[model samples]
Target: MGNFVRIPAGPDQSFDAWIEEPPADRFPGPRPALVVLPEIYNVNEWARGVARRYADAGFVALVPDLFWRLEPGQYLPYTPEAQQKGRDLYARLDVAASTRDIGSALAWLRARADSNGKVGVVGFCLGGQLAFLSGVDATPDAVVSYYGTDLHKFLDRVPQLRAPALLHFGETDTRVPASIAGEIERHKLPEQDLVTVVHPAAPHGFSRTGYEPFHAEADARAFEQTLSLFARTL
Candidate 1:
């Protein structure tokens, strides 16, 4: 249902992105779009798989290879040795550069036939933080964040997205400590609209199957609620 391709992000720089379209027989006309953001691994098989799932659900899904600026088509491992490399690469990333690349994808979607010009942002881990930030630059239809990494650190940077927002988190996620998540829950807004769901037994990456160590049975419930949020808002 999809494949990877390279596209220009800025002058003399190209990035890889997984573009997923629903089967031709299933998708007949223009549809909404979803920008699928990845975890620390950038655009890995799992991330692409998620894009396909979104496409199956009637969205044009795009997963960009954020690490491409440094190395094209790179996928780091979760091992201790590779973890250091991933951290180094993560540290080198310029937030403005990433938002620029993401904006390019959004522009492509809005102009394409499969998009109704309605866009939503969804991501896990590092990508989740970006999802929140993306809201500041543009008005998306909605934003969904899952156990967002470093979002608490940039809470001040959190965009007052006029669009509705739904956040999912794990109560036990040390990466996004419960304390900070609580603070996020306590904030007031002009819209006074935000949904924050905490999966009691899960931790960071709880929505992912392979993160079974931290996964919870309740994550399924959270997912259903997330879909409902999209339906109501997007």
Candidate 2:
């Protein structure tokens, strides 16, 4: 349902993005685009499936290779060894440069002939953090972050966000406790009106299907909210 395409990132640099487009017969006119940021595992099957899901919902979806600089095309499973490897790569990630890459992806999506020029971003795990940063730096039409770790560190940038944003967290996620959500709510800059949802009993990666920590009810609820946001803003 999706295929990889190269998009220019920086000067003389490019990265692969898994792009999925809606059927033209069903979605006749230009359609809104979505950037599906991946977890630390990179553009794996699950991430590609997410792009396909958005495409099925009448939106053009693209999942960029956020870890290209560290290990191009790296895809890992949910095993403990893979988790450690992902953590190692994440620790060495150049967040500023990666945010620039996200900007490039948004530009590419908007430039597409089938695009309506309104782009939104959705991400998970490490990508979730990037999604929040995209709201502040890339300036997409909408942003959704699911259990984004270390989001408390970026509370100061909340005032700089121009796009409508949604954030989700798991009550049982030690990496992002309820206190973090409370802090985020307290720091909400005026007019931003960003939403933060903490699902009861949901652990980290609650939205990730086929994983041990997946919470189906929470995933469905969050996805519905995300679709609603895109409908209203994008």
Candidate 3:
């Protein structure tokens, strides 16, 4: 369970976000926060479920509506039509503006009364790219990227990433084939704290529950790795 909130993004602009907070009795004081990025499906049930998962794990989770610029409050279903529409929106997106919204979301989390002033970002699919891009803008405590596609485009900014990062990839994913992921790994700066994992027998959307490629063992391991990262960094 979460509620919608408006977070200021830019000059005269704000976006909708889904806020899931941990139970007050369980977490009486400020708690660590996480910015959970959704897939191309936007902030639908699956995305909200992720936010809730983080809440149940004792962290305040926030899911920003990444498509606010073009279609505010629009939640796309998991269908062919929705996928095409999401791809269109993703293609036309202004990278600069999207990163700004991410910065705003992180800032909002840090300033929340219930926040412990430490925030970690975890993203899936398209959101995975945003998680990497956030390093170029905001220096969050930690970042976890899952099967992010087209990361080769942001290799130039790898040196700017200051936080510890855990990147997950499915060995069988055609979208981010081993060759491409290896290139990304090669670009990792010597000083950057990064760990890259390639899971065998897993596909593109292995972490997603209802997806055909969903692999429980791989997803659980990935999540455990993520929690360990945040535990040490956040």
lDDT of each: 0.76, 0.89, 0.86
Instruction: Give all TM-scores, in the order shown.
Output: 0.90, 0.97, 0.96
Instruction: Rank the candidate models, highest TM-score first.
Output: 2, 3, 1
In model 1, the runs with Cα more than 4 Å from the true position are: 214-216
The residue-by-residue lDDT of candidate 1 on 125-202, one tens digit each, is 888878877776666778888877777666665446556787788888877875666677666364646777777767
Q: Which ten residues in a row have the lowest lDDT in candidate 2?
A: 184-193
Tens digits of per-residue lDDT for model 3, 1-234: 799999997678888999999999987767999998888888998899889988988889999998898887768888889999989889977777877888888899999887889999999989998998886687678999999878888888877877799889998888877565677678888878988899888889899876667899999999899999998987
Model 1 lDDT vs. the true structure?
A: 0.76
lDDT of 2 by residue, 15-58 (tens): 99999999888997689999999888888888888888889999
What TM-score quantifies how close candidate 3 is to the native fold?
0.96
Clashes of 1: 1
Rank by lDDT, highest first: 2, 3, 1
Each prediction's number of clashing residue pairs: 1, 0, 0
